[model samples]
Target chain A: MNETSAALEVRNIHKRFGGLEVLRGIDLRAGSGDVITLIGSSGSGKSTLLRCINLLEPPNEGEIIFDGESLALRRARDGTLVAADQQQITRLRAGVGFVFQNFNLWPHMTILENVIEAPRQVLGYSRDRAIADAESLLEKVGLADKRDGYPAFLSGGQQQRAAIARTLAMHPRVILFDEPTSALDPELVTEVLAVIRDLAEEGRTMLIVTHEMRFARDVSTQVVFLHEGRIEEQGPPSKVFESPESPRCREFLASHL
Target chain B: MRWSVILENLPQLLHGAWLTLELVLVSGVLGLAIAVPMAIVRCSRFASVRAFPWVYIYFFRGTPLLVQIFLVYYGLGQSPWVRDSLLWPVLSQAYWCAIIAFTFNTSAYTAEILRGAIQAVPEGEVEAARALGMGRVVTWRRIVLPRAFRIALPAYSNEVILMLKGSALASTITLLDLTGMARTIIARTYTPLEIFLAAGVLYVLITFLILGGFRLVERRLNRHLRPRTGH
Candidate 1:
């Protein structure tokens, strides 16, 4: 309910598949430079909430507010809430960049091309300008030399970094990390986590869904525990990680940590 | 049985091969033009949108090319309606009719091949493009179609070669293509063996050249898949 500082807000998100509900009503907010990390057991809908925030998966109910504008919504004939304006949805997606767990970089394009594609195509940036910015972003992620290589040629950790660079190329106001390190090998996890830590130090507003309990505790300003598709507990990392309120949250943390 | 007859008729046979190349080249390009959009539509997510293209692909693929040629050439010629239509001039010529038939015929096959390739594009990549804010058209243009074409290059090369051999059927429609020239030389010289053998040689050579051309193109498109040289 604190509207003054919140950069992104989601209210009462309810989602369902054909027969099962994935997310019950959930409310959370991240002010500027806030790092909110969601942690829970596998089927607890940790990932679904992030998907709904960007309209990658529209919630059956609830609205997402980004940059102070609520997405225009209307009811369909079948009566599910859908985005009424496609352009607005696209604009919102561009502003809210997402890093997938699988590192879904387009395999056909080289690393540099992958990094520059959305900027040139979606943002209508000139090719040279996009390339220059992409090169720098890649360099920022310590991937300047691999820019010419294909995604298949890179390691999983390297690919994840490139994906982060790709998302950063869009220059989004808020970046969502959906289990970004889950797909990485154990040894490579540290490399990707290190890059994300640097971003955290730079005052980036990020919503991360991660299983690395230690990294999550160290990086996040607010820690949210999801259980059965609902926010069971949410607070500062010190309080939630050390002395949690809900028994389920504590049990889940004990099992993961 | 005179082996010298093939040597003497080489010029005429070469001219016939030239016409055959023209038919395949024009129709193949036209077919591709039709197939690109058709394939895109063929893979539409909605069953309703896929209905028409599915039937069209089925009809062309289910029937033989010879029959398709006859339907366009003889069947259309029989209709007084077609004769009076604006397309009659182009339709009246066997050459144009053969091109039209071949274009439609190959387009169906090419579209089907491309549809499979497009569908084979990784579902994750499409979602990735969407997540990056790419519109459907831009995604198809930049990500989907280009990647699909890469995956499709080998199968498409096979289709082109088949079209080359299929162009021999053009002779049945009274066009003096490669096979047509062979039949003509047989009639005049009464030496079917030498003339047919000579024509077969030309077809094989053309097929070889087509294979090489596609190999080079495939290499260029698939350079990323291969290990980078100069290491």
Candidate 2:
């Protein structure tokens, strides 16, 4: 894809926690409408990379360019590349939606309220407008009837879907899923994946960190294999999954799949 | 003791009971106002912001309420600096001294209770709020504080009831609250058991009222979590 068409670009990102290096000089590019699946072992830093993209965990060193804007390198008063300010980082974050592995719905709020809160508070949308938008998103996720239900009252899969709707309500340009189905029971995984598949079909730009190899192969346009804090191999799903060029990718996929 | 004497002195006991209830109400409200903010500060990321309440809680929770009252009333009176200060006008009154002591003591315990509650708010919820692009202040106000208050409610109610009992300490500072009035009545009539029992019964009634109020608040907070029957 052309540089201008790419929704997110990560260049030489490095992240460390104390003595451990989690992400080591990772470079990636994802275009609009691309569904990229990041598959890796537990300590492979796929989730960390996704978090860095949203500034949830700021990278130790990196450049993240989103929508033609340099998110990592901020323009100083003298027009040089400095660190991004809090306001700039927050504006960048608002454009990206995130769904956690554990389905982090606000247990105290009703599903409808959870969906509407960000729009009303962050996006500065009118309460009425936020409610209307939340309702539509909830309907799309098949959760319109569960509007007043609390997260505790909903099943795990249902809560994850509601969380997706909550993210969608903000009208984010890209959505990141960090093992969104990993916390679900085996039987419930399909339901959550179904909602996600629908999102993929609708051409929502997505980066998913998941272990479900079959789903990743079927749904993703590109699949990246992260091994020991580096991208071992990445390509279109057919080439990566069916005919992986790297032995490390083959070993990783063999163990997981 | 004769039932008639008990019946006759009941009006005096009720008057004292009213004063006791007023003291508790005033102190409990003021104590919570101080405690909630103090708790937030104690949990703050900055060490400087967190230190003052830590010292306050350590001082009050470590010492007896009686000692605090004595220190506020007698100790402050003994200090030449305090005597010369503008604060002396407020400190000179026994009622103000009692209020100040009760406010300080209860606030320490309440702050600890609220800090535990705030900590009990799941890390996941805070992360979710942050991912939603909520600023720190908005996240705390809308999500963290409300939920933390709910989690802290039972403990806070217990503290309120404890403060109600603690207010009896105010009588030591020479405030003519319930226990003080009871002491006066005992001195005049030489009926200690009769007066003390009356005060005890009034306290029990107030405890019941606080328990009922807490139940109402708990129900309102948990309404969303309750299961629906018809659907």
What's each prediction's clash count?
Answer: 0, 0
User: After aligning candidate 1 to the native by TM-score, how far in Å is the CA of A61 from where it should be?
Assistant: 1.3
Give a tens-digit lDDT track for model 2, residues B1-231.
745555777778777778888888887888889998999999998898899999999999999999999988999999899999999999998888888888888889999999999999988788888887888898999998898988998988998898888888878877767788788878888888877887788889989998999999999997766566747
Model 2 lDDT vs. the true structure?
Answer: 0.87
Q: Which digits, one per residue and each the tens of the lDDT, describe model 2 over residues A76-168?
A: 443323445767666766788999998888888999999999888888999899999988998888898999989888999999999999999
The TM-score that candidate 1 achieves is 0.96
Off by over 4 Å in 1: A76-79, B226-231
Q: Output the worst ten-in-a-row residue range by lDDT, candidate 2 chain B.
A: B1-10
Best by DockQ: 1
Lowest summed lDDT across 10 adjacent residues in model 1 chain B is found at: B222-231
Candidate 2: clashing pairs of residues: none
Give RMSD (Å) of candidate 2 vs. truth.
3.3
Which segments of candidate 2 are over 4 A away from where they belong? A72-83, B79-89, B225-231
State the displacement of the C-alpha of residue B225, model 2, in Å, after optimal TM-score superposition: 4.1
Question: What is the DockQ score, from 0 to 1, of model 2?
Answer: 0.59
TM-score, per-candidate, Cα-based: 0.96, 0.94
TM-score of 2: 0.94
